[model samples]
Target: MKKILKYTLASLIAISLANCTSDFEDINTDPNGISNESLTQMNNHIGGSFTPMFLNVFNVTPAWNFQLQQNLLGDVYSGYMTPPTPFAGNVNNMTYSLVDGWNGFPWSDAYGSVMPFALDIKNAVALGGDASGEKFVHLANIIRVTAMHRVSDIYGPIRYTKFDDFETTGEYDSQSEAYQAFFTELGTAIDELKAFEDDAQFAPFDMSSLGGDIAMWRKFANSLRLRLAMRVVKVDPALASAEGEKSLSSDAGFLEATDMYINTGFAHPLTVISGSWGDVRMGAEMESILEGFDDGRKEVYFNPAEDPALAGAYKGIRMGIEIEAKGQYGAHSSIGSVVDSETMQWMSAAEVYFLRAEAALRGWSNAGTAQEHYENGVRASFGQHGVSGVDAYLADNVSTPNDFVDALNATNDIAYPSDVTIAYNTSGTNEEQLEQIITQKWIAMFPDGQEAWSEFRRTGYPRIFPVVVNNSGGTIDTDVQIRRINFVENEVNTNGDNVAIAVGYLNGPDNGGTRLWWDIDGSNF
Candidate 1:
């Protein structure tokens, strides 16, 4: 047996010497110049890098506030990934009312690019196998859950069961069922990643640092689970606590909210025109909220409006109110555009803290104090956007912490308190606490678009008034509002049956105003 193994090794080495390069020449193909190692390995690495890059593009942070949606300032932010401001301007799709048609395509992107590549990395590692397999699955599942959570949030009960088979027909799956998949996947991922003992498993996968790459990735997975538990607090409170408890239960465990983020220190290049935030501006509604509170982040986030230093003149649109016809509001943005390439963000520490804060307030017992987790989220949000002296802000009036409403109005209040603390009154009902949870969830969303939209749809807390001028060729019913987007044009022509089945579940003729399954909460009364 020993002799056989030695000869087998010799055979491979001899082959390498005899004809390392294939003789076949199809002028287009390179035999000698491109090594087999390069062909195989580079393809996988390039594919891996490409997935994160493309994801950085679509994670737009949708909000009813100026910090989020203006063409210029908002675009430059890590909070949201927005489209190029069009010539006449706006997301070019005619179906732009409910969402930019692009944000609506996670199904194709996740299954096709994001999720599959992540799985590919794992497969490659397993076949011949690299130690990186663990991180590959961990990170992939983080992103996969991120995209899937949005799919379930946006469209309601999306088609999860027909995942690989959506090729035949895009069958619509139930929201509860889809969430169960997220539950199983997240739980398994956290367990698998936490169990991985090697530090080198994610060296190449590190977007941040080298030493603890896999550890950070493990935290990201756990943090993502924390976030999912919060998102469905409305749909399933029992499950929410169960998941959170599971994390605390893991002894050999992961990073908690206070230390759970991977800060993506993306720097700006020489050119703004091609940069990430260059074309996007802080949306008026978002800007107004920050400015109204004298929220320090306003300046860090937005350049003073080109013509006016007065906050009211900047991207100061009202939230959730119907805009008058297009003529009523200025389509032109007052702040400068977003420098696109300048920012990159990832699942953050503050986000996890905020999730835990909400969970704690609802009495989901856990590792950290609810109040501490809440303040950590606020502090992280402030620091990320360059807001200074945040520690001082929280310390100014330490006895009484500012609740979510206080923070929301901090920039807008006439009598804005100079000294406010991050405190919660347990006397506030669970209903009231839930509102506070979501409202800050709105503010902490400076750089994430999909989560903001998802939170808003589920909680409807930071409500936006209707669009004054929408030409989406669909009705904006006062009762139902946005239901779902009309199926993408190509899909209707190609996967008509699945689209038809989804429409049937919708009850409301299947357009943007249709209410999805989980979004069917609360009495509009």
Candidate 2:
């Protein structure tokens, strides 16, 4: 894979302006420092743009970038992991202080690395006048939605639909509007790619687990549609059901047997953050749930604690607690061999099964019964990790998440938030059944904390622990938890006028406490 060049703030602004301009020649002039004429040598004009889109979806290189882009926010908020280091003298994102400097990466990385390349593919294909090449545009759209939806989830309103329009270059889409656009784009991609299912033109540039098989790309698009469809179920149930059923009934199928992984040509970032730097460790919630369930995958996800007091135990640290130094909890479990490779998982077949399970719970058309899909989700996850005893694990109904015990500090420990059991709750309430499905989904989609955090906000399942110390100055509530991240400083500085208007689209003030459009604070039923 070609190295993705790092862009400074000025170049990123230049690229954004360049994208909005109407001149075709100006749009083709690569702002990424690659000459379009140079890229035409081997169809690299279109193919070359794909690598960055895949890499930036969940950045793998420059561990610090990934730390800021995901690990600091979603990974901590979702209860998957937390940093041992008390950044800024113990007042940081983990404590809800909402650092603007660190929070900007998710927005910047997506805009700089993902959106431009996708737009470039669309323009390059159109300028080439080869109708067959439209397939590349569709593929780029699928990847774009995959990346952009996470951005919209992070910050409620984003510059999406009107991004290419010169007049509305800095306009923002409300989360609802952005999601509607996602469904439309994903639907179009799934439909158009049907013609190119057997086309191998994408093989040379393919950096994903799909291996450039257009059929598999179609399946990924379909599965992604289901994900976005489920996301809006609370805010727009009718639209959710419509899109959900469409994906369920699509002939393109879903990610049933295989997972979607991007083979980033660089080392996985977690190896550096958790292993080399000792900056991140397992979270308290992970310890409670995995130990309570006697989950076999725990060993696969993290190594035993290195602290002499808890040696050989799978210990983890509680989030948002005061600590003078990293050494206090630095010896807690670090990440294991799961991220030892170059590939970063984007979506998994196990995740699709859980999505279908939720669709079934909601009575959507064509989805299998909740129990079957739920069990399949669990089994699929076990298979993905090559763990054994899945059948017994699935049948154990009495097991519940254990109470969290902070090894170094008893003050930070807490009881497990819920009594959600392992077995499928065949005779439970809709809320209970929903929790079962989502909790399993949460476990299945480990390490990909961006989606996990989004689902937690949407459904309130898996019962993540609240912060031990909220430093939000009352902007964020202790019990309510953080709903969404504030808009980045870069947007406010560069597109202040449009961002001022976008904040009005949010349900409340532009802070972490504001619930997004789909994060309705009500019953799932």
Top candidate (lDDT): 2
Q: What is the Å distance of residue 219 in model 2 from its true position?
A: 0.5
Q: lDDT by residue for model 1 over 248-350, one digit each (tens)?
A: 5554344443333232343332123223333444454454345444467655444553333334443443222233233333332333322234344445566
| Predicted candidate 2 versus true structure: per-residue lDDT over 318-364, tens digit per residue | 88998889988899999988898888999999999999999999999
TM-score of each candidate?
Answer: 0.69, 0.93
| Global CA lDDT computed for model 2 | 0.88
Among these predictions, the greatest TM-score belongs to: 2
Q: Rate the local accuracy (lDDT) of all candidates.
A: 0.49, 0.88
State the displacement of the C-alpha of residue 304, model 1, in Å, after optimal TM-score superposition: 1.0
Error of 1 at 115 (Å): 3.6
